[model samples]
Target: MLVRTFGWSFAITVAGLAFAGVLWGWQGLAVVAILSVLEISLSFDNAVINAGILRKLNAFWQKIFLTVGVLIAVFGMRLVFPVVIVAITAKIGPIEAVKVAVNDPDRYQHLVTSAHPAIAAFGGVFLLMIFLDFLFEDRDLHWLAWLERPLAKVGKLDTLSVIVALVALLVTATTVATSVPLQGGGTADKSATVLLAGVAGLVTYLVVGGVSGFFEGRLEEDGDEAAADADGAEETAPARRGGASALGLAGKAAFFMFLYLEVIDASFSFDGVIGAFAITNDIFMMALGLGIGAMYIRSLTVFLVRKGTLDDYVYLEHGAHYAIGALAVILLVTIKHEVNEVVTGLVGVVLILASFLSSVVRNRRLGEGSEQLEEQAEIPSGV
Candidate 1:
């Protein structure tokens, strides 16, 4: 399973490195290597979250994710995304943006960096909503009871996550600590633009999530009926899942899951596009490095889904969501403050590791308790 999951990933890695080596020889290769490491490190939590979603997708969608999805990750988000951003922000044609990126990478980097405030606002709010939505749900299993329980209570309010995200976006725009002057306008113009982009992100999340929920409801009703016919018994698990659930494979749920995965990738890419500047200003190199890293992350997601890693480490999802919340804050804060990519990446890594450790301890306790219960049962309760 591991080999099957990561086989193409290894191939992509080699191809990415070779692409870099051809572009700038050994120097480019080294930069791609470093960027790849940075991307994988920062995105490990993203992979975990993705695995939770991906396992719900069917075999066809799973194959689409590994194939078409990776192409989008590699070329779409890494290469074209920055150029598109620059083109929009700088009010230049796409051709001009591409030319500038290829011929004058430093200037391209400047344009991309200058647009970071808006980018951060969009990605930050989107990610924060994801984390908040997960926490706000009334789930039996609580990882951070002190906080999540209260959040769940508050979540009883309709569209609370959307409200909070809007408030956060407003606060971010207003309290950006020394307004950023626009290209040909005042700080107010830039702030308004940033707020609009942030709102766009919020809207995108709602539409996508709503679409997912719609399809989920449809599939769920069908699954419940199927389960009922099979045994005339209550659906033991969520109706959203299937028999291949142990494999994390979803039937029709794959479509929505794939859409969600792409949105999630776009959210992750905001930081990647920004962080690429710290390493190399070359757009092609950034794509090669970050794109390859994305492939690996996707591979990891598949591996985790296939191997039942999430089932084994139940609390891992909580940790990943928490890391996402932290990242959202970091992105919002970055509007005025320059944050280190290492710091950003390390925050996620620590949260995930901590959760993994907690899961390990919980697993051990559960195992021991089960053993004790079995022993007592064997001895006969009345005696």
Candidate 2:
């Protein structure tokens, strides 16, 4: 299963390196590989979160995620997005920016570095909203009527998320608008922009999310009666929903998975994208390096899902979410200043590892308790 799921990933990895080799010879391939590994390591939490979503997706959607989704991630987000950002913010002609990125690498790096405040602010605030929403929201899955009442109340409370998102958006807009006139030595303005950008990101999440939910609800309603009839015929059956089942929870899950994955990917890429300024400015190289890293992260997500790692380490999911929350805060705090990518990576790594170890300890104790209970049962109750 792992091989089938991730087979294309390895192909893409090799192909990406080969392309890098063509561009800058052996040294380029080495650099790309190192960067790719770094991204994969830093993004372990992302993979776990993605797995939670993947397990809920149908196979067809999963395939789409691996294929089309990857293209959007590697090319659209990592490559084109950065260049587009530089073009719009720097007032440089798009063509000139691309040319500068390709030919005059050093100058390109400077442009990207200069634009770091905006980029960090955009990614930082967007991720902050995501983390906050997940952490504070009441998310309890109930399977009974008694539970439904409380759950309904929680559902209504979703308005809080919307309200918070709106406020953040307003602040972000105000900051960006005011900061425009105060370029250079504009720490206050930059800080305002960062805060506003985070708000803008929250707004984007709410809007895009609402659209996705609307369509998903319509799809589910259409499929409901057919599913009910199908369920009646299979009393002794294993509750098989088959392909339709895939379309059910799985499809919805996949869509959200896509959203979450994209958000996390965007978060992790902020530093690499910003740090690329330290390398050559050639937008191509920047894109190439970042794209390579993205591919590996995607591949890692697939590997985790196919291998059932989440099932094995149930706490892994919790840990990743916690790490994402921490990273979001770090990004927000460092908006106007420099924060080492290594530090960012280390923080996430430590949080996730701690979570994993804790999960292991908890599971071990549970297993031992179960074993003792079984032994007691075998000996006879009264004895």
Candidate 3:
């Protein structure tokens, strides 16, 4: 199953590394390899989060995510997205931005780095919303029951997540954004920019999430109606295979979910794109490395879905959201201070590993309890 899932990723990795080596020799190959590892490490939580959403999609939509979605992730986000950001932030044309990226990479890197404040604000807020909603929402299972129980009670209040997110943005803008020092001289007041970007991020999350939810709700209604008329018929093959809902998302619902997934990917990629400059300023190399990582992530998401990993390791989703929350905080902090990519990757990996262990322990306890119950049942009442 592992080899079948990652076969394409392996093929692409070999081809991409070969291209890098032929063009720029061993250094290029090495950087690409490093960047690929870096991307996979940093975005492991992203793969988990994606699996949670991707499972809701049917076979057709899942294929679209692996194929067409990969194109957008690799070329669109990893390559063209940076160029577009440099163009907008540096006040240059698309052609000029491409030239700068190819001919004068140092300047290009500077431009990309300079845009970090805005990028961080937007991505930070967007990701915060995701984490906040997850943390607050009521669920039967709670990984961190001590904290999550209280948060779920508070979640009863309408729009609590949005309110908390806005307050955080306001405080951050007033303090951290205002104190960011410029490369040339005195500290620059980026509070306004931060607020604008943060609001944009907030609105984007609302619009996408709201629209997707609306479609999903409609689909659920339709499914309920259809089920009512079926006279207790057996579940469909797609329903049994995917198992996200009684009916897998298709048509409009799936389309919007795909859009939401793309936006989430864009938010996650923001920091990685900027951080890649620290390794190498060659745009093509960054794209190749990150693209390989993206493909692997896609493969992993599909594998998790097929194997029903989320169903088995229930705490995995909780840990992924906690990692996301930590990352959002880190991105906000990085608006003023630099954060090492290793630190970012380590936090995610540690959280996920911890959660996996917790799940294993829980499973053991449940197994023992069931065994005790079975022993009692087997014993005769008088004996």
Candidate 4:
């Protein structure tokens, strides 16, 4: 399973290294290697969260995610999107941005870093919404029952997640974003930019989530109607719904879900892109390295879904979300203070590992209890 899933990742790694070596020698190769490791470590939780969403789509859409989705991830997000950001932030054309990235890498890096206040605000708010929504949701299982149970109860209030996220954005903007130092060595007031970016992020989440949810609800309604028809009820609407309408609804749901996943990936990549400058200012090398890591992450998502890993380890999703919450806070904090990528990566890795270990222990306990009950039942019958 490992080979089958990671074969392309390995292949890409080698090719990317070869390309980097040809262009910029051993130093380029080393930087790409470091960036790849950085991306994977930081995004392990993202793979878990993605698996939770990807499993809902059928086989065809899953294929689309692996194929078309990766292109959007690698080229669109890693390459073009960064260029676009630089263009807008630097007030240059796309062509000029590319030239700047190639010829004046230090300047390009400066431009990208200059835009970090807004980027952090947007990504932070979007990720915070994801974490908050998951935290407030009522689930059949809870990893942190003491905390989650209370949050779930409070979540019954409409738009609670939105309200909380907005408040967080406002506070962070007023405090942290306002204190971020400018290139000229004085603090820059970025409160308005942060607020605007944060609102854009929040609205994007709502619109994408709403569209996906609407289609998913439609699919569920169709399913319930089909089940009723199977149970010998009048097959009035379902009989008409199955052929084309059902397929259309499924397609729509998958498409929107795919969009949601891409946006999530983009949010996860924001810091990685900005942080890449610390290692290498060459944008193409950054793309090659991060792109390789992204392919592996996508493959990991596929492996989790196919192996039913989430089902086996129930708390994995909860841990991923908690890690996301941590990341959101980190992004907001970084608006005023510098954070090491190592710290970001380690926090996620630790959360995921802790949850995995907890799941194993829980499974062992459940097995032991079942065995005890079986032995007691047999003894009582004999006695």
Q: Tell me which of candidates 1 and 3 scores higher on TM-score.
A: 3
**After superposing candidate 2, which stretches have Cα over 4 Å from the reference?**
18-22, 139-188, 214-225, 231-260
Q: All models: lDDT? A: 0.85, 0.65, 0.91, 0.91
**Every model's Cα RMSD, please?**
4.6, 5.6, 3.6, 1.5
Q: Give candidate 4's TM-score.
A: 0.97
- Cα lDDT of candidate 3 equals 0.91
**Any runs in candidate 4 off by more than 4 Å, and if so which?**
233-240, 380-382
User: What range of 10 consecutive residues in model 2 has the weakest lDDT sum?
Assistant: 175-184
Estimate, for each residue in 13-47, the C-alpha lDDT of model 1 and write its tens digit. 99879878987899999999999998998899999
- The TM-score ranking, best first, is 4, 3, 1, 2
**What tens digits encode model 2's per-residue C-alpha lDDT throughout 6-123?**
6776777788889989988888777777667666666767777777766656677777777887788778877777777668777988887777767776666666666665665666
Better of 2 and 3 by TM-score: 3
TM-scores for candidates 1 onward, in order: 0.90, 0.79, 0.95, 0.97
Worst 10 residues of 3 by lDDT: 239-248
Alpha carbon deviation, residue 18, candidate 4 (Å): 2.1
- Cα lDDT for residue 372, candidate 4: 96
lDDT of 3 by residue, 251-272 (tens): 8899999999999999989878
